[model samples]
Target chain A: MSQADDLIHQPLRLKIMAALAAEKGAPLDFPRLKAITQATDGNLGSHLTTLEKAGYVAIEKDFVGKRPRTRAALTPLGRKAFRDHVAYLRAVVEAAEAL
Target chain B: MMSVSEHEARGALAEIEAVTRRGQTLKGYRYAGPILMVWGVIWFLGYLGMARLSPALWGWMWLALDGVGFAATLLLAAKAPAAAGGAAGQAMRTSLGMAAGVAFVLAIVAVFPKHDLLPYLALPGLFVGFIYTVLGIYLAPRYAWIGVTLFVATLAGYYAWPAHLAEWLAVVGGGGLFLSGVWLRSA
Candidate 1:
């Protein structure tokens, strides 16, 4: 299986990835991403940092009015990895089903 | 060799990109428009079709289905971390809660609704949902298109469709969209 597939298998990260996939464009904000992923800021930030380092997601920071904001979006490699992971998941499920 | 774990650690970013278009973020609502549009239209059409037949029965049924669909969507979307650990694992559960809230807010006006309130309900309900969806997209851009679609369709429906249809549209159309949202988000 590809590395993306293995990472996605992690459950929480998979869903976060999937949730991000649903949007397909635009960066998810910290608070909103937290709400969607049901993750704490620190926890989510931690995961996001991981994703960012992997080059699967891009993180951008800016100030909106008074507050500092951090936003994340999927990178090109990130997209392929997700697709490959989904394919692998399908294969795994299908293979399991065939048994 | 890139062991699956190391490979994932190295390449997981690729998954994020695959799911979302380049240059997209969850903070912006650009992607959330489509699902929202489809959802609004489906609900509006449902109401338009059903209201002409049985208002009272359909009204109650709409409320029930709305809750069912909304609940299912949220249950899948709004999950907390499982001892199962893994961000991927809890992500499914995370969707359920937010999905439920989104669907609820999207469908709330239709529940055991009065015709008057029902007619006026879509306007605010959709507007709020549109805003929420947009925000959600910014948090996670992958599915933001769903929110963007909903937002656009909602505005179109609100501006173009008649008030009478709101009753039926909200119930039936909302139910269908909620179901779709549930399906899409489940995986």
Candidate 2:
């Protein structure tokens, strides 16, 4: 399977993507993403890189004058992948609930 | 730089990428407006709690509850993902640490009263509140109203509850603030 395909199976990564996707506007930075996912840097970044390299998310770089900065946004592919993952997770949750 | 784990390195990349988009994450969270919900609630609960509770004792109980709430906020904040400590984060973090430090000093100072030293408590107390208010209001908008609400709530509690019962209001008020802060900001 492709990287995106592999990604949807991981619960924490799925949650991170879902949170970012749910946001409006550009993208999320490390701290905001950390707050939403409640994941440490190592865990979230490992997942983010996997998505980034797969071309599922894009990273931007620049500054507010002198201040350094970074951000992450889901690519179209990433968004779709996340939705699919959510649906899959929902189905699993529903199935469990039914059982 | 060297201490970063692999995961942190990635987080740094993600955050560096964010700088181009807009304000850093701190500004984004401030504007996100979810925290505003917490802002409104924390104040409202404080208002109600004070209306319900008393004076002198309300001070102590609320003080304890606030102590606990502050601790919990720090704990939750610690759980937050490690973004590379940038200017904003470093400043915010330093100010927060100093604010806590001042409070600790005041807590100790509060117990020690000298005719000459007694006046010194005000310096630390005001200093702690000032740092707190500046962070909540100026830097961290998400939690901006927390300090103000807390201050107002205490005033209200001082007037409302009995001295003995005010302590309970502190516990209840802190719980109210925490729940509302999370619900409104996160939910």
RMSD of each: 15.5, 16.3
Top TM-score prediction, candidate number: 2
Off by over 4 Å in 2: A1-4, A93-99, B1-29, B32-153, B156-187
How does model 1 score on DockQ?
Answer: 0.05
Ten-residue stretch with the least lDDT total in model 1 chain B? B23-32
- Give residue B112's error in model 1 in angstroms: 20
What is the C-alpha lDDT profile of model 1 across B119-187, one tens digit per residue? 443554455456546655555543444455555555665567656445534654465456545544333
- Cα lDDT tens digits for candidate 2, B57-171: 4456446645554454445444434442243354346436745664776476568765553233133323434554677666555344555555554445445644533343335
Instruction: List, residue by residue over A1-99, the lDDT tens digit for candidate 2.
Output: 112245544556655665566553357777677766678889988988888887777877778699866788888887777666445444444455566
Give the least accurate 10-residue stretch of model 2 chain B, judged by summed lDDT: B31-40
TM-score of every candidate: 0.38, 0.39
